[model samples]
Target: MDRPVSKVREAKLELYRKKGNIHAKEVTGRFNTLRWGMVWLTQTIFYGLCWINWESAGSVRQAVLFDIAHEKLYLFGLVLWPQDALLLALVLIIAATALFLVTALAGRLFCGFACPQTVYTSIFTWIEARIEGDHLARLRLDAGPMSLRKLLIKTAKHSLWAIVAIWTAVTFVGYFTPIRELLPTVVALKTGPWEAFWLIFYAAFTYVQAGLAREAVCQHMCPYSRFQGVMFDPATSNVAYDRQRGEPRSNRRQAGQTGDCIDCGICVQVCPTGIDIRDGLQYQCINCGLCIDACDQVMEKIGAPLGLIRFASETALVAPEKHRPWYTRPRIGAYAALLLIFCGMGVWTLEHRSLLLVDVLRDRGALLRETAEGEIENAYTLKLMNLSEVPRDFIVRVAGMPGARIVGEERFTAEPGSIRPVSVTVAAPSDSSLSGIQPMLFSIQAADDRSIEVVEKSSFILP
Candidate 1:
């Protein structure tokens, strides 16, 4: 005879081992339709934007290009220099705030619908289903012995996956390079070393990640799933298995004796991450709600109430408590406020952006020199960067002194998207009693657009 505690521990160990693995069947529902819609919308925008070219002032480039090599970002009519990296930082913060707001309000809508991993995996699985058949047939095919049909099916599935992976890779690299040029080079097998390497690398990554790894990426690879717990509270609604009404579970058809759940395991079958929802909220759960769809279908077949598995808060299901609406949630409200503030700042920055930038550096080696005309002169270097798409002729002026003026010319022309560094001399009348190192402003105004002006302050030294 075995000791009672030892037998109980052994039984628990066996149960834990069994519980660790779950094979979820694919499911279709309203949420699934919405998810696929997002997939199409996002992928379409990503691919379409790559091919768009915008022509400005005789220079043509991709409408939205992040030219890392040139340290310049081009967005349609806007050009962002390296100094404007703060805008990128603000954009990231805004995105993070948006994610937080959505998570607090609805749950992991990002993970479920819009995440690349989920979307790509959904596509890969759809292709697999087309080639391999339904869930039962797929399982059977995998279990069956080696055959010509199996090999053909596998070959066809993998070939389609490879094509999609390659296309995805090309579109990704298109953000940095001109897509029209890159495509021809790729087709002719004349792509440069780095481009070819990245194309192959990204394609292989997509193929392996989406087709082979699948849910493992969501469960073990992604850090989002791990940190998602930090965003959750008792009121956070998640896809849950209502254990109160679901358990003392059995497969029998007894009336009113057991709870509604038939122990059909449809919820477990439809889960992509292979985690049983009935076991309680686990870290592996993406809150996709596929289990709800599967459970609802089962409930309908057995003439029971729907929503055996549904989106509900732990507080709502377990304890009798009134949960506040989304807008009332303190964390969500705070995130929303921050998002609005940053968005306003970004808009203001764009609105007040100048078309030209000027930097005036005084020649420290030799300051003030007496000219042959009996006037005190200062030598300075002016770096004028044209930020606009069109060619600009700027009328440069010097201010802060009564008789101060530029030596030779007042206007200079700058080509579109180019920087011009010109040496300039400023002269002051000898009789004028100007002090040593007096403050002066160098202002540049565009001839075409009077609203676009940039000013830099420098010291005017006298001998």
Candidate 2:
């Protein structure tokens, strides 16, 4: 009996060191509602955007298209060229700044509620619970021998997982290919090589990460889980154990003799990542607050006060006099300021975007020629890009030189979404004042709407 007691104590110590699988009990609260709201909002937008299409005035429709082959990105009314890749860079910076601000202010709120991994894992786990039963039952089912009932349950679960994963992949590819055409092609197994590869790869990734490696993705695969500590401060809120209120834990019967904690270990059981909140913050803690809900339930059942495990800061629970407000935190303020600046830049860039582009290149073979009319003339090739949806007729004109005249037709027609090249001659009288490489402005005004103008600067040479 003495030896068995010693072995039991040793086993308990080992279990304490290594966390067991958390069969997190379901609970309802304000945070849980907020999490579901985010899930609805994000998934709705993601799936909705995949099916939306718009008809442009050009041959091609104005759908969400990233025409990488043509080096163009079309977003609603905006057309971005490769030279404007800075916009993508600015977007990334803004995203980073927003993450920093959120992390400093709320501590892994994004990870817990809005992150794709977390959201998908929640969905996958919900499906698992529906098919395999609750936490204890799921464990039992996994350990039991293979049977027809188990096979049927597993098949249903995996079939649903595959459908969700395939849908996710399809939506991701829709950003590049028109979903209407891509879907039919996918069904026929006739998709382009790159598109087919990406669809399969993304589907496999979703299946493995969400369906199989749920918690392992957070604990071992995600770099964010490892570096989240650097963003943390004493003021940052996290799922923290209130050790002062629940230490020297004992059973519910002897509650007054010890702390409020009954040592029921509900907090440990509910954690999806299988972590013990009572052990203090670990890298695996996503700050999801499922543990808080679990502990709250335990406290209520034992006739004890709640918040034995809660969303709080280490300093707030430990030091009474040094508590600081969230906004006053220096790191959070800096991150917020940066996010605001980038957001402003993005808005400004969108507002001032151009609808057309022009490039004028002077003929290099012969700079200036003496026409039969004995006037000094220069040859130029004008490249006009009609970036708008409507076909536009443009009247070409020259400025910056007095008495400069166009030799031929002054107007040309450009098809919508097409680049047209027109060759024209600019002439000046032999005696007219002109020297080598005189600065000139070639302007094109839309015949339909004079307000839309594209201008390019070039030089006219006089020999």
Best model number under lDDT: 1
lDDT digits (tens) for residues 373-414 of candidate 2: 888898999988887667888999999876678999889988
Q: For candidate 1, lDDT tens digit of each residue in 1-463?
A: 2245546644643443244333346678877777789889988998899888899777677999888777779999788987677777888888998988777766787888888898898888888888888766776677688899999998999999999999999999888777888899999999988889999999999999999888888889999888888888888888888888887676665777778887666676677887678888887787777888888888888888888888888877798368776778888878889999999988887787777888888887788998898888998888888877778899889998657899997788887668898888898877556668788888889988889898888878876
Off by over 4 Å in 2: 1-23, 58-63, 67-74, 77-79, 253-257, 431-433
Compute the lDDT of residue 9 as modeled in candidate 1: 47
At residue 344, candidate 2 shows an lDDT of 95
In terms of TM-score, how similar is model 1 to the real structure?
A: 0.92
Work out the TM-score per prediction.
0.92, 0.89
Error of 1 at 123 (Å): 0.7
